[model samples]
Target: MAGNPQGHQEGAAGAARPVGVLALQGDFREHVSVLRGLGAEVVTVRRPEEAAAISGLVIPGGESSVMDKLSRAFGVAEALKRRIAEGMPVYGTCAGLIMLADRIVDGIRGQESLGGLDVAVRRNAFGGQTESFEAELSVPVLGDPPMHAIFIRAPVVAELGPGATALATLDDGTVVAVEQGNLLGTSFHPEMTADYRFHQYFLQKVAGFDNGTARSSRP
Candidate 1:
């Protein structure tokens, strides 16, 4: 269920702008809660118009194929792609990371993605739900204490293109988080933990983009 579309929150240059969370499916409510707690007006985006109203968006962890179908059926997929092309900041977590990848290694038949981040992702790279685990990742970009990440049937970046930079990796050197321009992606559920650094980092990207200080990474 989408949240009410009316509210004012301080953002870039002290301007008010809403941060949207794709609410067609998944743990969107968690993302919404985190963003709202961060003092930003949050919008639960369902329809295309809702997608258009936000300065930045967060695609939550959900079933990637189902999310893809619902977003297209609801007519928000194209709108989001357009916004990404226009340099709007976006943060994608877990399945959301798969949706933002340029290539999917093991997507279900006919499955599609929004395709913004320049990387190839292998769905279910860590196996089934029972294989889900937690890890403390050292993300230099975030600094200080390591980020505690939860992976639930998560994807992994198989091939990170030159356009994107790896933000965090596992002890085995497997890429789990990436960033490109105004876009950020992680194969773990940041919203599930107490740490809000990923969300805060994403908000900074949103602020920069909204202030016209962010350079578009799209080619």
Candidate 2:
């Protein structure tokens, strides 16, 4: 959808165009709740047609391998890759971050990622779910007081290529958040917390893309 001069895209009835949550597998409902709370129309995407309709998409935290398998099985994987290549804004969290990485350092045998962000991610970099923890990260893009991030079975960016920029990292220097043009990924679950800045930041990218002002860094 072409965005209006104000950078808000609207549908036939003049409602804002929906932002999609990849619902094949993940904590998608939490994302939907957050997006709606931010005043954006949200749609749960499980099929190719749904994937094609959204101005932006959020891939939520879950089992990355499972999400990969289901997206391919449901024929939405290819559609999503195409959309990413076409400059659609996407925000991926935790397992969702793994799916968007170009190189998966520890993916299961035969596992595949949609591949857009130019980075290598190590699955479960912080051990297992029991090892999950929270940290206050310094994300200059978000600015001010650090973001309280919750990491659960999160993947860490092992190698960020020239095409991507690190947005936030732990004090120990582990990369936790990244941005590449219209694509954003985090090694934590923002939906699991009260902070909505990341979601709001992503919507701005969506608006930019819809208005034909977003730059694409697909690899």
Q: All candidates: CA RMSD in angstroms?
A: 4.5, 3.1
lDDT of 1 by residue, 1-219 (tens): 112222334444676668899998899999999988887788899898887778888999999999999999999999999988988889999989988998999899999999989999999998999999999999999897999999999999999999999999999999999999989999999999999888888888777766676657586
Give RMSD (Å) of candidate 2 vs. truth. 3.1
lDDT of 2 by residue, 9-98 (tens): 655667556799999878999999998888777899999988877889999999999999999999999999999998888999999999
Q: Please list the C-alpha lDDT of all candidates, in the order they appear.
A: 0.88, 0.89
For each candidate, what TM-score against the reference? 0.92, 0.93
RMSD of 1: 4.5
**Worst window of 10 by summed lDDT in candidate 1:** 1-10
Give the Å error, residue 162, model 1: 0.4
Candidate 2 achieves a global lDDT of 0.89
Q: How many backbone clashes does candidate 2 have?
A: 0
Off by over 4 Å in 2: 1-7, 10-16
Off by over 4 Å in 1: 1-15
